[model samples]
Target: MNITINRAAIESIILEVPDVAAAEAFYTAAFGLGDKLRFRASEEPTTGFRGFILSLVVSQPSTVDSLVGTAVEGGATILKPAKKSFWGYGGVVQAPDGAIWKIATSSKKETGPATRAIDDFVVLLGVDDVKATKQFYVDHGLTVAKSFGSKYVEFDTPASSIKLALYGRRAAAKDAGVSAEGSGSHRIVLGGSAGAFTDPDGFAWEPHLASQ
Candidate 1:
């Protein structure tokens, strides 16, 4: 006889919000996650969890969506805009459970089929000096990888995997495909796991742990 095991593909979830109204508006506007998938009041109530969908609450709804939106819009050139019925698009959102939402624009894909069935996660970070930042991870116990043009970097850790990029504060803004006056926050809390420090130039890095 043959046997098989079943598992949920999505390993992690992050939701961001400034206020209830804003959270409701942003997720609906950005990911089309459907408004108030959980509650009808502002009491922040968390319902039950179904499979991979984990709900977290946000105190406020205002979030930094411009950068994320721009990146998704740019990447859409190579990918496809997420559809309502898509497997990658189906998830639950709830209140009171402390839902943390990260609102980024969806992408549109080309004709090629996906070799890998599911994408686990995509991480973006800021860096002041690419060379020095890359070295720091190498020394602090991360296996570092990079693209040829110094455009992107990656680090593998036991707890988690992270993508560390070298962007000259101003240039980094352009990488995100946005225009910002100065530097953004360069820190990662790592959900209480091991944390990594950035270099003098303000390059930040994080570790991602693959869920089983």
Candidate 2:
């Protein structure tokens, strides 16, 4: 579907947690995501996976090792140890605040004609219904690049630094090897020019205004 809307690339993700300080420190020092990391404390303690995963795509295998090691040392649980895969070398870690992250580097040296830096970012949300959730974004003017039968979906968001994806709730949890059951608030805020709205799964989106 062809739909165009006035929107910036997804610039930042806000993760709500029970302990903002701990989450901030873990992301900043361990994942080297300090620049994009922001946190807010909940009125009460939070539990569960928070319904999303943050993916960091680096250019080198060594970078993946270093980042995963740092995350483990900083109190993250290694859900999947780093290893070589068909797509690349990657692993999973669950941070102190119950947020899961995937770190990886492509095996292919050259990506088509372009050779860019190693670091890239993506936000993957686990939704109750992938097709419906994807339709929700399409209704908001986002375009789709690839989609599968109610299992996975990815948006064509080249303008945004951080890409957005959706997956079936159980499928996502299975990929991360985490429990499918999650409770409490998701504690997430997606920043973009898409204006303000909440997805079917209750994730918030707001416009990101750049400073003059």
Best by TM-score: 2
Candidate 2 — worst ten consecutive residues by lDDT sum?
A: 108-117
lDDT of 1 at 32: 43
For each candidate, give its TM-score against the true structure: 0.40, 0.85
Give lDDT tens digits, candidate 1, residues 32-127.
Answer: 433113122233222322111122211111221232343344332212222333322222222222332222223323224322121223334445
Best by lDDT: 2
RMSD of each: 13.5, 4.3
Give RMSD (Å) of candidate 2 vs. truth: 4.3
**Model 2 Cα lDDT, one tens digit per residue, 1-212:** 11134353576777778787788778777866544556767754456667888888887777777888889999999999998889888899988777799888886343343332346789999999999998988888778889997989988875435788999888788778788887877878887777889889988988654430
Error of 2 at 112 (Å): 16
Error of 1 at 109 (Å): 5.8
